[model samples]
Target: MTTAKETVAPSMLAADPLTDSVDWLLSKLGKHIVMAAPLGLGKPNRLLNAVYRRVAADPSLKLQLCTALSLDPPTGSSSIEKRFLGPFAERHFGKDYPRLDYTVAQRRGELPPNIVVEEFYVQSGAYLGARQAQRSYNSLNYTHVARAVASFRVRVLVQKVAREPGGTRLSLSCNPDLTFDLLTETEALGLPRPLLLAEVDPLLPYIGGTASVDPAFFDRVIDLPGPTPKLFALPREPVTDADFAIGLYASVLVKDGGTLQIGIGSLSDALCHALILRHTRNADYLQMLEALSPGLATCDLVQAQGGTGPFIQGLYGASEMVNDGFRSLHEAGILRRRVVDDIAVMQRLNSGNA
Candidate 1:
């Protein structure tokens, strides 16, 4: 078994210029290439663009790009809401992602006849509601990414990450979600390990967890200096009074020393905020709770598991995406509990004898 340290060591040769990397990848191309998507913040845009150029140069070379959540800049829309959001989205996210090659080709109805772009999770927008996207959409669950790649006969896998400063090992900072699983699946099936490519950027934060990959795993490495592409920050949604009331109700059921698995968005934010308020501003929080639903604060379940008192043991976060809300909760000293993975230890903890 490969140890963590061995698996995260820098062992591959680096390509200094973008062209060298592109040429290396192009030479090993198969009919299909699977790329990191939706989670496109960590995607290798330069290398993919180079692939697009190659496809443009050769009309008969059929290449299927399989991935999900291909984010595109907002184009004009007819609906009033879209009209307002379109310009706002463009003003913020347009220049950063700049005419993503496949999206542009898809929008202009000029994708090469042989080059097919398939997205499992469509970006939610007026653009996706159009005829072309709807016609080309391949609906699938996120868990089925490996199966999709296998079905498409994908022989090349490419993703982006942060290189350990002055090292070659890459950190899948924002998207260790699927790449590891994809690699595992391909390996288990007795398939030749797909040609792995890593585009190393300097700007991505080297987050912890199962996010590191050895340079040996990658067939080629491209070092692109300067700022990496900015991620599409899902703007925090505004919280309403009703939303806060619901959050207050939900917060009372959560055990003080339990784990949290909150997702991204306004509802999650409201819930976390309510929990923090319940801990720090208990009197005010209880008053609001009383006004929203009298006697809820006095329930036996609430009395046992919830309270206005500050967290003594804190809560552990075990979420897929540790969003800004979790960061805030950490800052407020509420998310400090750490869980271990041993069954015997867990039993001891549950029995309050650890």
Candidate 2:
């Protein structure tokens, strides 16, 4: 029931080089010890057994065992999510563990009893068009789902909590402070707030687009763990030639040195792949650039300043899930954060300001 920033010492990095400043910053927010065993905890799973016993031992705390398993370094295919979390839940929680709720940013269906799921939606043209086709277009983005959930009059958790120094931080334990911003907005719209509880996992990997949140407003800090929930790969439709053709067309909207905020899924991947190929093969496009700016057209300038290489220069992911593909791009040193979801950053990339 509080909202304020925090400050702490940068000490952990001195012990382990791998200790990230971000990790330390996130630790300040406390999270709940949801007594449950995940499929595998990177150990002998002994901790899992211990946690299960602790949960069983505690009568005061309600144990809504969850079977949702997030596979680390997800690979292979979409079905991999089921392959991991499904069996894990079957073995551990069994009957007590509730079913998984897979919806994103919007709760379209019912969730398991005692198990709360979060859904937040931002206003988009397409969404409005589908719901209110006759309404005129507006220049502002609005939150539709956030409003409905807030009407339930429930406490919602938020992951972002800013520390005193300057930079923002997430709770290391992954527990987030709840806020009623969305609910307040709903109230403004004359809706009743629903009875709600939002479990914020501060350690949730921060994304780069509309998904960004400020790290200063939270209610309670619970002790959640790092690498929060692993996204189980959901099923995706098969890709076809037409899909690629459309993706190629969409790729045209992007400029040569422009920054991109790629959405999740295969379609986005197709668009990225096609763009890379075009950059490699399209001599006319390259020449057009050379004609425009002789300094920028040279091979050396293109390679160094323009990030002309065999792979993509750098593209930011603004989506929620930081899937394996995004990880790969990050590991390859192609991912750079100019700042926290800044439009100027994107514009600079597009104009080749770097």
Candidate 3:
């Protein structure tokens, strides 16, 4: 039987950027056992260099490093640039230290060069307690992910975890709601949550999620006042006249003060800008009640006035990446949750529910 090495270090340095932390990792665990790091928000290249320097100097400690570099599918660099240039950068220093690569969630239709691009799909026997685990599998690729995780014994280390309805998944926030969502998906796939939550100092509260979960779920909780892997808020691109033309149509359906949930895209931004323009120019943008009586038979007049509906009390975003424009709407109190799940409810919420 092969003896497991004593004191294995699964360094998740990608989540946070701290030199002392990296140095401590080097001193204790050396540089060989580190796997992948999340490069969305930190000085990842710096960490990689430090790891390389250590590994290059000591022939006995050649390590394999995995990285999940951020790539925007819509308008960012193409797949060829990402894959070809991405791995080339790390391996360019020569055989002293080789490059380790992998792909993360990317937009559809992009074919990355050199590196293996993972596909998105639902797995079998992964529907948690649903009737049929193999029913209408959305994508066969995600199922492969489940198979790999089960086979490879992958471990996910993070600052927090949550007990979702489907199962527990590592959570990067205090938000139980978000935890529930991630866990539900994993549980459906029959995969145990591979999260090592509350194992590190300095917990970070992600801005997007509900931000509430039980403290007992954490193994170790330390207070550190800094954002972990600070991500740039998704950028808002400039809109064109064609964009405005589309926005006007979408805007015509919006209720004046009703809650709205806009999906991600140029159309959403245009709609927002158009709404602001109407409110600024027409002054008839705010909520107005019927002259019958105060709060008697309240109907969203804003909707009638080419604004959003009144009963649109709240908005809940179901988008994958929360961008700046979405954040702006939330901050402006235009986004809220709606309990109704009907077409009327949706149409009433946004001027153009379709």
Q: Count the backbone clashes (under 3 Å) in each candidate.
A: 0, 31, 27
lDDT of 2 at 250: 57
TM-score of each: 0.81, 0.37, 0.42
lDDT of each: 0.69, 0.37, 0.40
Stretches of candidate 2 above 4 Å error? 1-219, 223-231, 235-238, 257-261, 280-354
Best of the candidates, TM-score:
1
> Which tens-of-lDDT digit does each residue in 1-354 have in candidate 2?
212333223342243211222222223322222211112111112222233333344443222222112222212236877687666655544423222222210123322232332222222321222322112122222234334334444322222222223345432221111223454665786754422211333323443333334443333333323443332234455667666666555545554334566655678666655555455556654454445446453456344444323334455555434455456556654455444457887688556784
Model 3: runs farther than 4 Å from truth?
1-69, 72-193, 197-210, 214-230, 233-235, 255-266, 277-316, 337-354
Q: Candidate 3 lDDT (Cα, whole model)?
A: 0.40
List, residue by residue over 120-234, the lDDT tens digit for candidate 3.
3322222334322222122433223334323323233233222334433333433233334444555666766543324222223333234444444443232223333322334
lDDT of 1 by residue, 206-292 (tens): 765568767776666666554555655555679887787778888887777888888777788889999899778889888888888
lDDT of 1: 0.69
Candidate 1 residue-wise lDDT at 83: 78
Clashing pairs in 1: none
Q: 2 or 3: which has the higher TM-score?
A: 3
